[model samples]
Target: AARLRAAGEAAVARHLQGQVGRAHRVLMETPRMGRTEQFAEVVFAADQPEGQIVEAAITGVSGSQLVAG
Candidate 1:
């Protein structure tokens, strides 16, 4: 059991290290008036421990039902 735990921790460490400086895609939604504004594509990067979002860029927004992209 102890060895398994150690291996798990090591795997997590390797994953985090490998993800450093790599960009990931994220989707988010914001409430606008009575509607939800969907951020269709957001580029995200980790900049600190605890996987804090250090950098983010919104690449596109799902145009509103009444608005055109």
Candidate 2:
């Protein structure tokens, strides 16, 4: 009986492991859907006669700086 129980437990564990693997695969393969706001970065130089406006797509943020791509 003990051996049978051990075998049953192992079978159940394998089934659960397969289920978890399938779930993980589904999550990794799924495309994320959401709305993202557009942002721009502008730089002004003190020596420049006219201020220049630089437009770029903001991909991420690092500390207080914005990463553009």
Clashes of each: 0, 0
lDDT on C-alpha atoms for all candidate structures: 0.33, 0.31
- Candidate whose lDDT is highest: 1
Model 2 whole-model lDDT (C-alpha atoms)? 0.31
lDDT tens readout by residue for model 1, 1-69: 999998987775554344434444332233211111223222223222222222333223232221111
Location of the lowest summed lDDT over 10 successive residues in candidate 2: 21-30
Could you give candidate 2's per-residue lDDT for residues 3-68 as a string of tens digits?
Answer: 999898777555433332121111111122111222212111222222223333434433322333
Error of 2 at 3 (Å): 0.1
Candidate 2: Cα lDDT at 65:
28
Candidate 1 — worst ten consecutive residues by lDDT sum? 31-40
Candidate 2 segments whose C-alpha is farther than 4 A from its true place: 23-69
Candidate 1, superposed: residue stretches over 4 Å from native? 27-69
